[model samples]
Target chain A: MTARFAVGDRVRVDDRTPPGHIRTPWYIRGKSGVVADMVGAFADPEDSARGGDGLPERPLYRVRFRQTVAWPDYAGDGRDTVDIEIFEHWLEPESG
Target chain B: MSTNVDDHDHDHARTFVPDEEDSLGQYAIVEMAVRELLIEKGVFSADEFRQGLEVFDKAGPHLGARAVARAWTDPAYKESLLSDGSAAVKEFGVDMNLTELYVVENTPRVHNVIVCTLCSCYPKPLLGAPPDWYKSRNYRSRMVREPRAVLAEFGTTLPDGVEVRVHDSTATMRYMVLPMRPEGTADLTREQLEALVNRDAMIGVTVVPAP
Candidate 1:
């Protein structure tokens, strides 16, 4: 399947927690970030976790977030940043 | 019963059992049972399972060290490595298959560190299984929260000017750090350079010290 978001699109991770194994971390959930890179498509790990055939691969993107935004008590300078790989289903385009 | 004191002493000796925790004992029992079931069902033979394990056993950090050393010496190769790590490692006879490898570089301004926040997703083809600490819950949770503190525990103290970029391996992609080549190693041979590259350095816990 083709990727919906490009390298520079702004997106926010969906905050809702699903009942199964998810690749997105809790800290990055509901946080907004810019897409760093497209990591190609692969089997949805959520489905694979349940022993179900992981078909209909989803595009994964490396989302970059400022360290300060991720952690309120972040000790580092503003230059620090974190990159997390999030599946397309977990991300939504940020509204203006 | 008191008539046979010698026989009673031996019986007590037999009854005394040491309380030791064999961490792998339980897993081994389960693994053997599962293997037997699979074999009985004609899934895969024991020989095939052993062969697969042997492949993982043969892989080590040296393979990744070779790739890092090559990148240090060759600029064009470094570019290729930074762009496509899985493809560039093939030059050194390391096959990563379809596993996506993204090589993050550690520069003067940017210091890159990696962690599998969800689970232990590592570049096992090049570096083998992760060290015990890498898979610990402390490292997984703390690394993303306080990378500098974690690095310091590994005896790595970076300058305040550098930006600590932590890459969370949260998806199918696995990451390896292309650590900055230590200064004063210009005269060293390729093999010597490779020797200096350790697993921790690639994981971004510490830098390769100059030898």
Candidate 2:
């Protein structure tokens, strides 16, 4: 239930694809972003969807990524960004 | 030959019923079944469910507009709204219940737009059900990728220096945009300001101009 990543910490979304309903978007997987805010914790939908208790809520964060990182062909201002809510388990400390 | 007056069988081609698509989808049917089962099981009474529906039925963009007007006229209130969205909205009688409300401000340098790339996770307590376009697959996929182009489609062309911030409501938190007040409205009353704030403006698809 504790948040490993704090605000301003750099993190990258894990690029794993599992079966059943997922809260993480496919586009954001493997992409890097900065933790913008700690979103507390909630039952991980990945488990909750399967009729599990979803106990020990997973910490979530609002990760902000440059729009360019999401779409390299993006034609808008380089500073444009996209903020998405991601669960802690889906994020890993940025390697580089 | 028409047994019923409304049928109008006199026409040569009846057109196979105008809408074969009226039937509820699989998930919708499942939801209904689950709801009935819960009510029957005493998880909640039917009247309680009806009360919940009434709350949702009473929602619309005007509730959000009222909050926007208050924020526009009062700097202190604006700070509260920007800091804790759900708490500030509660003052105006918007209770999001378990769902958290995240308010993003649109400033001169930054323009904010909201979308649920996964599904339609809007701030329904403040703005009611999302528009059809908001729930469309095209919007869910493209808004985060080409927000500028999407804004252009909605006739919202931001300045070159402005940063377009796209918020993907992928998780539990619902989002609503607090658009920058248009110019020349300095003399307008609070009610007038609320009248000027529309659904699209709060959705961040379009910016309202002063009349």
Candidate 3:
């Protein structure tokens, strides 16, 4: 699937409770952020159950998140930010 | 943080068994069985298996440090480093077919952190097999949730305004953080810089120069 976000575009990591054979990091689940970069697409490693020698390819995006936005009352300075590159399935358009 | 594994082990004495299970016992039971089965099936020779272990035992992080030092010394080479890591590493002569390298950078506003949610995906060709703590589930689970706490445990607390970027190395690409240089090391050579570069700096736990 094509990447739905672009550099500097705001997005949020969707908080989906997946079951069995999961890889999206727990800390990042439900965290909101902006797309900082678009790393090249690669074959989806999670869709191994499709029963094919090769899996469908999907794009991954590097999202930048401000720590203050993620963990409220985070005592450190608000300028602290984190950038994590996540696969397309983990992200979605921000609602508010 | 204290490298003393004992400091954190309050209840470890209750579970300690020094002579209980030797590596030979575990290897003899499980690894030997697997080796025997593979040999019986003619999958690989015993000699080949032993040779593989020999090669693995010889690998470590110094090679990666050499590459880092070389990059620091050469400007054009550092450019190559920022662009393509594996090719730049090749100039130092570290190569691997199965593993690809991604060099992450640390900035005043943005820090690069790394984790292996699946298994420890380390730069073995340079950094060697990941350390025992790195392979633990505690580090994998806690690092993302409380990076600052963990970094503090490693004796590295970021400045008030510095950003913290955590890179999870779970997929095809393995990552190593290229930490920013420290002050007071003005006339130091690349070798000196490499010495200042610790494994924790590469992991984003501690910065260079023992800070």
Ranking of all predicted structures according to lDDT, beginning with the best and ending with the worst = 2, 1, 3
TM-scores across all candidates? 0.88, 0.87, 0.78
- The runs of at least 3 residues in candidate 1 whose Cα sits more than 4 Å from the true structure, single-residue gaps closed, are B1-24
For model 1 the interface RMSD, in Å, equals 0.7
Highest TM-score model number: 1
Query: What tens digits encode model 2's per-residue C-alpha lDDT throughout B52-125?
Result: 99999989999999989999999998998888889999987889987898888999998999999887999999
Candidate 3: segments with Cα more than 4 A from true spot = A1-4, A49-54, B1-28, B39-51, B96-99, B117-119
Give native contacts recovered, as a fraction, per prediction. 0.93, 0.96, 0.38
lDDT of 1 by residue, A1-96 (tens): 788899999998899888998888988999999999998888888998899877789888999998998998898778889999999999899894
Assign candidate 3 its CAPRI class: acceptable
Interface RMSD measured for model 2:
0.7
Backbone collision tally, model 1: 0
Provide all candidates' interface root-mean-square deviations: 0.7, 0.7, 2.6
Give the least accurate 10-residue stretch of model 3 chain B, judged by summed lDDT. Answer: B14-23
Q: Which 10 consecutive positions of candidate 1 chain A have the poorest summed lDDT? A: A52-61
